[model samples]
Target: MAKNPDIKAIITTDKDLVINSGVPVFLSKNLEHLQVLCESLERILDASSHEINDETVIIVAR
Candidate 1:
């Protein structure tokens, strides 16, 4: 993904989750639905107490 001046970085995952840093961004181009995708991930994360990745932060851009 191309870098943006306002964003520090853009990350693409195998599951089609695009995460952006510095500025929050979620680019779910291939996901079935944005809400479903986020809810699914949220369930997975809620199952755990500890942080999965210190560097990874989930943010919703409205």
Candidate 2:
């Protein structure tokens, strides 16, 4: 038996939290990007309106 097992722990103090796992990231530095994302998100939400009935969290990046 191994004395110690390999494990990973994540800790953060950032108000904006994100987790990275080789996934692509979209970063916003200005209102333009935010606006574009909002519009796109609205379209997606509208398309999937029936699937969402509660407050949701949409994380964009880490």
**Tens digits of lDDT, candidate 2, 1-62:** 74542212212223254457343233444445544554565464342111111222232321
Count clashes in each candidate, considering only residues at least 3 apart in sequence or on different chains.
0, 0
TM-scores for candidates 1 onward, in order: 0.30, 0.32
Candidates' lDDT values, in order? 0.37, 0.35
- Displacement of the residue 50 alpha carbon in candidate 1, Å: 20
lDDT of 1 by residue, 1-62 (tens): 97522322222223344433344344544434444445655564342122224323343222
Give the best candidate by lDDT: 1
Q: Which runs of model 1 end up more than 4 angstroms from their true locations?
A: 1-26, 30-32, 47-62
